[model samples]
Target: MAQPALGPAEAEGPCSTPLESPVHPVDEKPAPSRLVPAALQHIAAMYAGVVTPPLIIGQAVGLDQAGLTRLIAASLLIAGCATLLQTLGIGGFAGNRLPFVNAASSAGIAPMLAIAETSAPGHQLPVIYGAVLVAGAFCLAIGPFFGRLLRFFPPLVTGVVITLIGVTLMPVPVSWAQGGDKEAADFGAMKYLALAAFTLTVILIVQRFGRGFVRQVALLIGLLAGTLAAVPFGLADFSAIRSAPESLDDQDDGEGEGGQGE
Candidate 1:
């Protein structure tokens, strides 16, 4: 059945009325493409950082280049695995969906060094591992109970904890600025200081002036620039990375019977 056509004014009324159209809210979403690439670049930047500490420590403990290389490889592999677990999350593990790499924290250095002096030959690595294992267990033991204790932490206590964290972290920046090692031949050299300054400048510049992709990749860019600047000064070494083996047995835990680097 056909109806009479509407007048121009009546037809226009429906089109002009704001309520005539069903409105849906639009959300501005960030581009996934940008985030994915930026994330990969971030992973690339942290790869070296995750591997280098074990290599340096192994060498300090008198491990051969091969053994140190193995330690480096293990460190990288473990960190990658931990990161995967943290990001993807198993049944009850993992912290968040964001990437999170784990390593032997520097906070344990003083304790480890103290243990090293008294530990028997080839006992260091095992001792370190054992300590780490125990620490994890201790955390597990205390976590739920400690979480409940959060109610007791008032704002003042929380603020004090935060202040303490800042106080502790101040030394870390100073150490990096002066070069990571105190015994290095060029420790506190201008070259090292310049590298640190350049790194800081890169981060500041990227944060201040960069947009989108550049901003997302700020950390990677800063690290890369800093490393590259250090390369000509012989600060970067691929020697350990290249020689690193896939086998765990190649590294000697601090135990003499356990093997080298111990």
Candidate 2:
């Protein structure tokens, strides 16, 4: 009643045939058409965060309008390169290759402004840059060894770190919504709160009800909506950019003086 055993070729044939991988939604690569929009959305989300740091620190260090513009352009370029390195990586050792967006941290603003405050008037920016260079070198040198400490932080401890970061940053939004500077007379004005609420409501509505690309670009749309809304209230002002110099040489004369230095 027992069947005869298969030959070696028959047995090996079944084993040698390639097994197909199961298609998983989670592992699926998005089409290039859809991929671009997804990336832009992430850029939209992080744009303000990346731009604000350079603006704040550059102004605090007493950069002129021309110098501030150069700082902002440099910041954006560096952030883009950092993000690419983080997501794509060089070989296997350099980058995390995660879905993370790397940019300048707002957390450093206080320390940097403190540095600027202690420095002499015309010398502040040079000192701040030197400090930043030294700090960056120290961080890079310690990174490999410091990564080993990750094992010491359980989920609870990690959660505490996140909570502390959020708690510390919570005041920044409150200050922004109250008209930026805490010492200003209009620091707790109702107009700013109303503007912020209106912007939030518009963003939420677009995100919740919009379909396809509308939903994807809600942040950008909300910003446009908010700017238009601000016009009636006289809150938005862009006079500085309106008065920008005609030529690039004049705009960034500091760099134009020398052809290209080492």
Candidate 3:
């Protein structure tokens, strides 16, 4: 068979030997950068976050200054320990070193709030802890079964659950927009609305165009942005521990003891 010769124009165009398909680069995983800055960032991010829920719940329960102060401290300490356990996993007991930072899960928030509201006529921390212990046991007993049944969840069921979760969480954004507490005198105030709007805008912008690391951290960025924006309006309180009288502390202790006796 006779081979056809290429046209002069085609022959001159970049040596035309099929161009070796341009040798596209393989998507190799990038080497991890130094851990010092990342670890510091993780710790700082987690430390500030793990204390807020207890503080809010304490306030909701009408705890006097001292009682709420202790609650906040305890929450921070426990959260720190939980985070350490997660990041530096225990052999068969606790940890799972997966960039995991443990904090209070939002799933428990509503139930805990209910307990805080209905807690027997006095200090509710003990009751809350007791209930948490029970709930944790319940989860531990069921979690493995759920894990084993992972294959049972097909795409349809996963989609339904995800849709339901989104629907359920819509109220959280609404509540935050309305200042986070239903009973607050300024609940639903303009300041809170503005903060929520700013956060939503930032997230939307990120989702629309952000790439790589910026896209990955968009939620964290939005949260921080919302928090910073709220600070000037008295929404993000980072005041150092304020002193409370010993009498108030003793009073709570007495109430707690009395409630336990009853």
Candidate 4:
């Protein structure tokens, strides 16, 4: 009653293991030259998205220039802190130690605007803040359960959600192409349309033909190229940079004069 012979794989026992996938060099710590551009590319990709929420809310709340500046600064600081915490997890506490950029979510804009509209003048922001705090706490409380529930979302559902998001955001680039201001005299100028078309073409070309980091940063490259092209068409304005310091100085002088008079 001899036993049957074992298969080749079983004969090798536990020592026989599948070969692990090789890691590409680009996945590792890149050179300084590559790293800087790659980092700048990520910044370019998310910069507008990161600032949009605060910009819209600040305008809606009637914040002054200085106040808007502070809001933007604070938003950037908090996002940076959150990104650090996420990448460098605390001891048995917050963060998943992943590479993620945390910023003000555009998803909350509608609800925030509603809250602002419902609140009294000069009190809208406070109400919005209170609501945000409660929402944050609620999210924290349900974090574990929420993660568990994600298992119910199959790839089909996830793909549909992603497609829906892309569809929803399709108008953003269209708005940008229309000069970003509906009231502008040349809102839908042919030049702007051409610029957008050129940018999209560049992005497509890069994605199709470029290799390595170039392909990875195609969107950023397209953005930069479009900006450069815009300058020649009088679409890129640098007047704000020149006026910002003067505005700050004027604000400071006004404040000082008021204090002296008092």
Could you estimate the TM-score for every candidate? 0.55, 0.70, 0.58, 0.67
Better of 1 and 3 by lDDT: 3
Give candidate 1's TM-score.
0.55
Against the reference, the lDDT scores of all candidates come to 0.69, 0.80, 0.71, 0.78
Name the lDDT value of residue 162 in candidate 2: 68
Per TM-score, the best of the predicted structures is 2
The local distance difference test score of model 2 is 0.80
lDDT of 2 at 116: 84
Better of 2 and 3 by TM-score: 2
Clashing pairs in 1: 122-254, 122-255, 122-256, 123-254, 123-255, 124-254, 125-254, 252-260, 254-262
Ranking by lDDT: 2, 4, 3, 1
lDDT string, candidate 4, 27-97, tens digits? 46778997788777666556656777787777678787677887888778887788789878897778987
Q: What would the per-residue lDDT of candidate 3 be over residues 63-155, giving only the tens digit for each residue?
A: 866677678778777877877887678897666665666766545656676787788757576788899999889987887578789889999
lDDT of 4 at 187: 95
- Give the clashing pairs for model 2: none
Q: After superposition, how far is residue 229 of candidate 4 from its true place, in Å?
A: 0.5
The per-residue C-alpha lDDT of model 1 at residue 173 equals 61
Error of 3 at 4 (Å): 45
Candidate 2 vs candidate 4: the lDDT winner is 2
